[model samples]
Structure formats: structure tokens, C-alpha cells
Target: MTEMSSAPTVLVGAGNMGGAMLAGWLDSDTDAGSYIIVDPSPSPTVQLLIDKHGLRHEKAAPSDVEAAIVVLAVKPQMMETALPALTGMIGDDTLCISIAAGTTVSTIQSFLGDIAVVRAMPNTPAMVGRGITGAWANAAVSPAQRDAADRMLSVTGPVEWVDEEPLIDAITAVSGSGPAYVFYLAECMAEAGRRAGLDEDIAMRLARATVSGAGELMRRSDDPAETLRKNVTSPGGTTAAALDVLMGGDAMQDLLTRAVAAAKKRAGELAG
Candidate 1:
């Protein structure tokens, strides 16, 4: 295994998500000199990373260098213009990882040649180091390369791998966009609290703390979420009353199913 300090990891974009991963790596004690940050306009946060790490910064990918891993974090729409510049940098042994949504392994391979490619979907919470990633690799990736990809992505959060590339679209629907769904839930909950006569500020604070605390509990607990809900609910109580509305005819479940389906369909559309 290559030492984290000596490994050549080229980051293609140091935007929010990418910068978060870089910060996580730095915090985890990976050497500052390990990264080559390629961004046309570095954000203030990324500029700090450049200064702290003594990282190599370039407006475009350098032609002569070989990287152990090249991470592509640009927007899907910008991929066409961005990818061609790095084609020369991708050698057969290099593991190329893409965090852009709706971009496929085949499309990435087409741009960079037949190199190992891993397509990853990571949500926004990664900015705070709470993100989760779903990844799928093409046939060219060896077991070692897959492990390396997992290690690199794990810097942001837990990494889950799907056997089939298409499954990444489902992963996209679930976890990639899941944070927004949770945020919207908090918004609605706060509005409901306001309707229940709480002050707007208090409502928002309660909603935020409730959602985040429950999420942390879910993360730390071994019991199923259903059990956790049942434990909180009393017979014919306020919690039960709310559950009746939410669970009535499986309203929440059906609604979420439709939402996820729509998201998956849109993801597939974007892939094409």
C-alpha cells in the first residue's frame, strides 16, 4: 500500500464537496503534499487548503504527471469541457473516481480511455463530515484499486459499493439526494410547530434539534428504526396520533416511494 503522504492524489475540483473531502483527509493526517488541486477559480476555503498543505495548484491538469488516483468532482454539465484536459494524466494503473451525479462509468471511460473508473454519489452533509457515498466501479478496476477508491472516498463518510452500475441511480435517489429530503422534512416540521402556536424561532430550533438528535440516535443504535419509533410512541398518545396521520394507508411510505421513483427516473434521464 502506498503511504498516504507519498500517494499522488489529484483532485479535479475543490468546490464544496471536494473541499470537504480534502479537509477530512487533512484532518485525518494525510500529508498536505499528497494533493494536486486542479481548479480554475479556487474558493477562499480551497485557497487556505493550498496554503496549508503546500499543495500543487493548477488551473488545468498538468500533462506530465501521473496520479495514483484522480478524483473528478466537477458538475455533470461541465464534465465535457473538464474531462478532456485530464485525459493525458490518466494512465492504465491510475484509479479515476468521479463524484459528479448522473455521469456514467462508460461515459467517463470514453473520455479518459479504458482506465479504471469509479462513479460516486455523495450528499451535502459531507461538508460537515457526515456524508455517505455510494460507489460503482467499471470492470477494469482491480480489487486493490477498488479498495483504494473506498479508502479515498471514506475520507468523507462511509462508502457503500453496488455490484451493478445502474444501481448507483437508485443509490442516487436514496442517499445522494436524501439530505435535501431530510432538510425539507425539518422545514415542514417547523411550519407545523408554528401552526401549533410555537414561536417561529423556537419551532425551527426544536425541529432542527429533533431531527439531528434522532439521526444521531439512529446512527448509534443497533435497534431498527421501527423499534425506536415504537419505543417513543405511547398508546392513544400524541405520538401515536401523529403516526396515524403519517402511517394511515401508508401515506408517508407511498409518498416516499413515489418521490424516490421520480428521482431515480430523473437520474436515469440525466445519465443519458
Candidate 2:
């Protein structure tokens, strides 16, 4: 368990993901005073937390206090624009946790020299606290510091440590960009339901709930997803009938492989 109250967390850019983390921290054992959020146009989530908890909200960098943990939550493209102000708050020992996709450790080190940094790639589903994050730490981070990063990341959902920093791109491709794929699956399923003449709202509700419920089941159960899938899919059943067309030519697999490759390419471009 992480001692959330022991050290203050400063988050830069309370956008979708950063705000989700702030919400999660608010619900955690962490003290309200331990949290700080920085963003230009704060979203509804940020506003709600500020009004309810009186959590620290600043339009720019907070200078009065030095944070034990600083989260760089701005987008990779925006980091260059927003990072200089953050340097003032980064004490020699302050641990930096960056959720900026495609912003490498080297890139951040250039902005904030020698401050320990842990790079993380987390998906959008973290908004609901069902997200998983894959993180990488540069050699400068202490073992204890890395552990701290893992626990903090785990607050959103599951956390995995990557041995190679470049693997963050793979993580981006597989998981960071993975949520959209799941969402699209739900959309497609709903559309298919509508085509089958079900009412539009009912079709959408069924698709969303079924997909979400299956994901929850996978999360809570001991059995593998394949096992659960097979359990529901009877021989020559409706699902199996659909599977025959979808999986027969390995169509879904091939399409997803291409999609992941495209995501990986874009990740590289962003890193570059």
C-alpha cells in the first residue's frame, strides 16, 4: 500500500488523465492537502474536485512548495511549452512521474536536469479507474523511487514495469491506445445490433453493457479471457456464427496488427 498522505503530489495539466488521477487520489487514503493540480482550462472533473475538496488548483506552476512527487501530465507536444516553469518546483530530490506519451526520459531530463524521472503511458479508461499503465524509469531513479512510481501508477489500475525505455512505444501501441479499440468494438457491436432491427438505444445499451460487463468479469475472475469466451460461445451458436466470419480469415487479428503498427509508427514520430 502507498502512503499517499506522507508526501505531496503535484500534477501539471489536469486534463482527462491527470484529472482522473486527481480524482483517484482524492478517493484514496491521501490527504486533500497532499494534492495539487495545474491546468489552463480545468475540466468539469477538476472543477468538481476543487469545489468539493478545496484541493489546490493553480493556473500555472506552483512556486511556494516543493513537491515530493511531481507528475508531468501535459501532452508530449505541450511539454516543451509547459516544462520550463516546472523546473522551478523540481527540487534536487523530487521524483518526477511523467504520463506524457512519446516524451522520452532523455527529453524530460533535458528540461529538468538530473531530477529523477519515471515515464508512464496510461490509457483513457483510467478515467474510470479500470486503466492499466506501463512505466519505464531511467537509470537515475532510485529503487525505492521506482517502487513509489509503480504504486502511484497502480492507483489508476494495474501497473507494469518495462525494462527497456523504448518499450513505452509498444506499451503505447498495445495499451495506451488500446482503450479506443475496445470502445470501437462496442460501437461496431451496437451498429450491428441496429442493423439486426433492435431499437437504437437498446442496441447501444446492450453493446456497452455487455462489453463492459465482460471486461469486469475478466478482471474479477481467475479464468483466462479465452476460457470465459469459450464458455459462452457454444458450438454452432450465435456468437460462434459471428466468430466464423470475423475470426475465420484471421481478419480481426490482421487488422489489429496493422492498427498497432500504425500506432507504433506515430509514437516514434512523436518521440522524434
How much lDDT does each candidate structure score?
A: 0.89, 0.87
TM-score of 2: 0.91
lDDT of 2 by residue, 11-105 (tens): 89888898888887778744688787888788897889887998888999877877788998887889899888887788777889999988988
How many clashes in candidate 1?
0
| lDDT tens readout by residue for model 1, 16-47 | 98899888878875567777899998888989
Score residue 40 of candidate 2 by CA lDDT. 73
Residue 173 in model 1: shift from native, Å? 0.6
Candidate 2 regions off by >4 Å?
A: 1-7
TM-score against truth, every candidate: 0.96, 0.91
Q: In model 1, what lDDT does residue 269 have?
A: 96
* Alpha-carbon RMSD of each model: 1.5, 2.1
Residue 266 local lDDT, model 2 = 94
Q: After superposition, how far is residue 72 of candidate 1 from its true place, in Å?
A: 0.3
In model 1, how large is the Cα lDDT of residue 271?
A: 97
